[model samples]
Target: MCGSGQLAVLLVLLLCALRDVAPLPDSGMLFPRESPSREVKELTGLWDFRADLSPSRDLGFQKAWYKSRLAETGPVIDMPVPASYNDITQDPMLRDFIGWVWYEREVVVPARWVADEGTRVVLRVGSAHYYSVVWVNGVKVTEHNGGHLPFEAEIGDLPQVHMMAADGRAAYEDVYTLPVGIRTVKVTSTQFLINNKPFYFHGVNKHEDSDIRGKGFDWPLIVKDFNLLKWLGANSFRTSHYPYAEEILQMCDRHGIVVIDECPGVGIKDIRSFRNASLAHHLVVMDELVRRDKNHPSVVMWSVANEPASEMPPAGLYFKTLITHTKTLDPTRPVTYVTCSNYARDKGAPYVDVLSVNSYFSWYHDPGHLELIPIQLNTQFENWYGKYQKPIIQSEYGADAVPGLHSDPPVMFTEEYQKLVLQGYHSVFDQKRKEYVIGELIWNFADFMTAQGVVRVVGNKKGIFSRQRQPKAGAFILKERYWRLANETGRLPPWTKYSCLL
Candidate 1:
């Protein structure tokens, strides 16, 4: 058993052979098999919508409101699809509404596009907030939980409506099947494999957070973030606490950025919440997550939960059930839950395919003691490998560095301090590469807004780049580190040349 001090010294010594790595290969098509011969319709027009304010129950879903043309209702109004329901109205109640809201639109399929054995009608939604269910001509087609990405249902042979003379009533019949796609992601005992090649995650953890959107889908923000990721030499990112807008994932697929598709299972701390309602809801979220993202090649893995209470015995069972169900949904990808708990003590660690542990060594644990990070991180990695014998990814690790803050010899929140902290962590990462440690994704790609509190000046300032997507001084340090790692790991393409920032 290596002590903490010995481990730190070993990591420092291993850093002597420091070297370079790059962007991942193109993630291929998000929704593949599209061509000029196929008819693709944009469902971006106004749709009849209403909010269920009963508060006691999900009246819209429960009453099967999708069966009815919502225009027949009195409170219905035309709300735009592919936009957040929050900002579409001036009403504060509607903007802040947390419960069920119904959206309905009538889509007319071109007669020429529908033919027996030759045509397929796939209804692809860009994104919907929270939970959404769809219907076409009084028939419920599909239901999904996540708000960030797109979900599609193949509504085969649009509903046939006929009048029944006996009762003077109309009847409808519709048949549909889910789309089938290929799965190419695999995980070995040593590394994460994509299409059977060892793919290192050179990336960051990000949130779908920005100004005014409040988790709403925004295309400009998506483009900007992708550009930033490219510039930073990062080719991957975890969706952090939840799934992002489908458009973003589509962009990732186009750009070759691998994604760890995570669910919105954040803040699940209490044991009571862990058991009855939360566990059931978690499974639903998992089903929806896989249904929406399983087709995308960029989505390499599923992160079911973020920072859950994994040490608890109940949490072990809770995550075990969730992971087991997730595998059933999409076995092509590995499933993991991001844990902030100690790896040696965490009961939930055994249930996941990969061990993703979040550690804040010098920053959160021994604040300002950067020297202790190497040994401490080494011991933790060794202990986890000893027990589980699984590949590990340092999923979240960073110091909160406010832009422009500076100090000689490095102090907390300064750019210098952030650089040093990352250096320390990277040193251990280099040493542990020979061991089971597989990847390192920093806490954030860029700074983002969090709830207002005394601890946060504006929001979480741990990003290598500012919220506006501008790089801090620490960004250069990471760029070099990532570029070097990519080169060393043979991830860099032959066409690219290595250059240093002077």
Candidate 2:
């Protein structure tokens, strides 16, 4: 109880304060250290999951599943992230029949490594089917609705929000995540905030029917598809009809590819039922998507339906309702629905942030109608502009090229023909139109898988590249055009023809 004793007490207090400030090195796991601030966390490990038919039913997930899945004596099953059940299940359920699927994975953060201001950690999810709710450690940090987009959540601070009690159960905000110094996070559609600012997106229409993976895909194949698109100057990509795997979105975040996430609810014909069912399903997916992907910077738009209700009047109402639902969940991004050529110019079409039209003037209309192509194409853009006066996107326009075919006299399959068509198309786009044509994304970057046996040139040659991901001579022309645009530092002479480069 003398001077030495008081000095010892002071020393102990100082050491405790220092421990708080400089956590042990092991705590580093709590704060993820990845480049670009948006690199997706590798959530591609084992996950305990079970399916539920009634999404509306009050089926408990936190207690039974988590306890059994995490039990020492319980069996450990692998649930790879960025993967779909149908792709792995030998006797998979039909796409429409899949209901609720519960997933349980343990999340951890070392005690010393709590996220400080400079090092913020986020868990990102690429896509979930219909709907999903994520829990970290043992607390629900996020909830999401849509399935086509990405979602994220921050889960670091624990003592301030929750603390371990004598009973050994962690508690916070009434819900719990996992129990490993782990902070729980949940994601929902309304929360997919981008840079704290709502983002408007533009990108290419993507279909996932590959010759290699068919409609089913794994993580590796997904990454390859993404890499191919990035090389072609694509900033954004759409899933077109179905919700893609979570890995695809994760790859986009890593490589800086913005995704326009869509759902699996394509070929939807019945609009009356769709109004109730599709709208609810789309919103749920949006909720999950925004919640999980909110932290990623690459996502910018939400597309609810693609070519819906092709020949139905209620299609208008369905699209209108879906857009409204999406905005309600997350207004930070614009909403769009891709319509067939016939309905794209419909006067009664609902309101949208951007006016998108899918036209194939150069294809199907008449191959040799070079002179008339511009007149017809420009009119479509003008018609949408005259009514909406909103930013217009010539969303889908590209021709198929046969592989191994080169230029001959009359040169139909040669690079010469490809360049000529591109030149004529750009000429039309170059004209001063009333509507603001912000950008144009061709229908695809490469040939995709089509099961209906409707593809040309042994596949959907509509892509500049083929299904093997090979350049079909036209790819060179595209690269040249992109290079010319990138190199235009000043008043460069009206860029020369792409054929000249060859």
TM-score of every candidate: 0.72, 0.58
Which ranges in model 1 have alpha carbons more than 4 Å from their true place? 1-38, 45-125, 132-146, 149-189, 194-197, 493-502
lDDT on C-alpha atoms for all candidate structures: 0.72, 0.51
Deviation of model 1 at 423, angstroms: 1.5
292-385: candidate 2 lDDT, tens digit per residue: 4545455566666566554566655656666787788776667766655364544225556765567766566777565667888788767666
- Give per-residue CA lDDT, model 1, range 116-187, as digits (tens): 334456666655655555666666666555445556667665465222223332333333332443448777
| Model 2 misplaced regions, further than 4 Å | 1-203, 209-211, 215-230, 269-275, 341-348, 407-419, 432-435, 452-457, 486-502
Estimate the TM-score for candidate 2: 0.58
Best prediction by lDDT? 1
Q: How accurate locally is residue 6 in candidate 2, as Cα lDDT from 0 to 100?
A: 18
Which one wins on TM-score?
1
